[model samples]
Target: MIEEIDSMKNLQNEVGRNARLVGRILDRLREKGKLNEGVPLENGGLIKIELNHIANETVKEHFLEIANDNRILAVALNLFHEEQKKENPMPVILVSKDVIMRVKADTLGISSQDYLSDKIKNYDALYTGFITVFVHPSTIDSFYTEKHLPKSQVPELKETIDIYPNQFVIFKDSFGSNKSAVARYNKYTDSFEHLYSPESVWDVSPRNVQQRMAMDLLVNDSIPIVTLTGKSGTGKSLLALAWELSKVLDEKVYNKLLIARPIVPMGNDIGYLPGDKEEKLKPWMKPIYDNFEYIFRNRKTDTNIEDVIAGIKNIEIEALTYIRGRSIPKQFIIIDEAQNLTRHEIKTTISRVGESSKIVLLGDPEQIDNPYLDATSNGLTQVVEKFKESKLSGHVTLIKGERSKVAELAAKLL
Candidate 1:
């Protein structure tokens, strides 16, 4: 990074914003700004390792044929392990996220593993905040008549099922009948209560069961932290934005609407920009503005489109760096594309919320851009699993893209 001395990362600008991968090593190097070119450490120095030759091309092709930087590192580690095995009574392991590095190290008799400290196990089975249970037809009837059913009435709850607070439940008759009801688990009452929120906002409504659950949670003032996760075009960001608009501009539930996202696409991680903060964020916030435009220009709201959209107030779309130390109170905050944030970044974002504020985290875990994170280890999935049982939090995993025919097909087939 310091080789050319051109337009690049500045240490002053990277504070609290850059990725944590090489920061520690860079800090150590920064102390000794100019290293002695010929000096070497007491124990060792950088040495070039050459590739081993073999007659078989096919076996060799699979074995370090690429000769990339990762392969070179793996070969070096293997060589060091082979030498140290005779002296030190310790295991030499290669810790990396690179698949080729791990596989090559394992094949060369060196222990290897992905960083496991923050990785969530069995991410495929991550909680969806919704489940379907088959019960007797009479139970569905009772739910319709009483508007609430005791947790004990559902025999499935007594078994291996462990439902979370604010979990949405779909009750279907075990028999062939079409009787069904959708209810949400009320942790305080120990019951499944019927959803009563007005489902329509600006002529936009949920098209699937999971979307309905997401709307229910979004409209509920009791649940301050909401998470919406799904594939692209599944309306994860749209739903949060819609509900935030209604709450902030219409109902005045919160003082302001602050929307922030990880600054990945702009540069590396919240890199330095030359203009004002808002100007620097305009390009990144186009999606948020587009959603607002779509909501205002819907088929049924053309008459009030200009008035409603132009008169909109108290909404801020900016980078997460600006929102770090501010006391954000009584605001409806949405963190878009939250999957790119690390666990520490997510924690810092959440900790900034003040009293009477609502924070909704929206993202598709499968679509992650951070090199150090995965679907399992990303902040979105981690927070969903960690807050599954919190009475103050709610989550819904939207399935099936409702954006368009081509969008749905691409989400599945592509």
Candidate 2:
């Protein structure tokens, strides 16, 4: 805690925005100190602040080999907990967001836990928009012929499984004769409708059933909010951009296509990067730009990339840091790398959507770059689980990597 406090005073050590926040806190400490005399304490609370209660030499020497700030704090905290145990029988648990630190605390016999207030669910149990259901061959036949199957058709299944609107469903034959059908649940009609999306978008076909299901959610105008979570090469961004380009350019359903990704919040050293915000962001946004080039090239647009972007003046790509307080209407917005966003930032970004706007959160929960966010606590998973029951939103987790043989192997093997 002491080392962290010292580091926060230096702009070079602290994050760009946290310096001012720490300064205000320091100022408040000084003001409160003047009123309270020698020691500063809260007005009325069981909790007490221990200032300069540094750990002893034994604990310090034990952590000297690691020489990291976090390890040092862990040593100090462990010592404090040990000392407190002598006076009281209360449990001293170490609450932190760092996984490694939690492990270290456990090694030292300290009770540690990840901060759970922002966590929506565990990564393994996260809501995937698609589910497979084994049913009678007669039900699959009826679905294929009638093109829709009422939820009542599977009354016994509902008692065991919960259904949500816009959820992708795959009905398989119970007898296992390879008879199957793919459908999407319609909460309004309470029926399973056949997948009705273009076979391909921007000349890119849905490579697998998950991709096909994702496409169904992407192009649905009725579903205003969508989320796609997957590893690299899963085509989350490609599918999102495909829909944005097709909708904004071909369909003209939305006035603009906006893509915003976190730059400074991704724990990258953007301060030392050359040029302005846009230039600094280019390297980070190169993946999105690459998808654009691939889509335009495959679509047979002879125009240059610059000219293409110039012609489609409705499309915008920039950093998420600049999206605050902006009301976007009739726009298709994609929040890329959304796994790096905090819960507060997610709420802020999603709330910026205006009437007629469709927002899609896209990223891999397993590949988060934010220091304080993990798969379960990140904005992507938060939205996926929280909005699963909402009719206006849908989500799909793409498992297959369609980028290339080598890329797919690396995404899995590495």
As a TM-score, model 1 comes out at: 0.78
The estimated TM-scores of all candidates read 0.78, 0.83
Residue lDDT tens for model 1, 100-196: 7778766666778897878888888999998989999989999989989999988877984578999999988899788889999999999999985
Worst ten-residue run, lDDT, model 2?
45-54
Q: What Cα-based lDDT does every candidate model obtain?
A: 0.78, 0.80
The local lDDT score (0 to 100) that residue 228 gets in candidate 1 is: 93
Question: Residue 46 deviation, candidate 2, in Å?
Answer: 4.1
At residue 311, candidate 1 shows an lDDT of 61
Which residue pairs of candidate 1 clash?
none
Each candidate's clash count: 0, 0
| Global Cα RMSD, each model | 7.2, 4.3
lDDT of 2: 0.80
Candidate 2, residues 251-331, lDDT tens digits: the string is 999999999898734454656678886677778877777888888785666776746775767889888888988999999
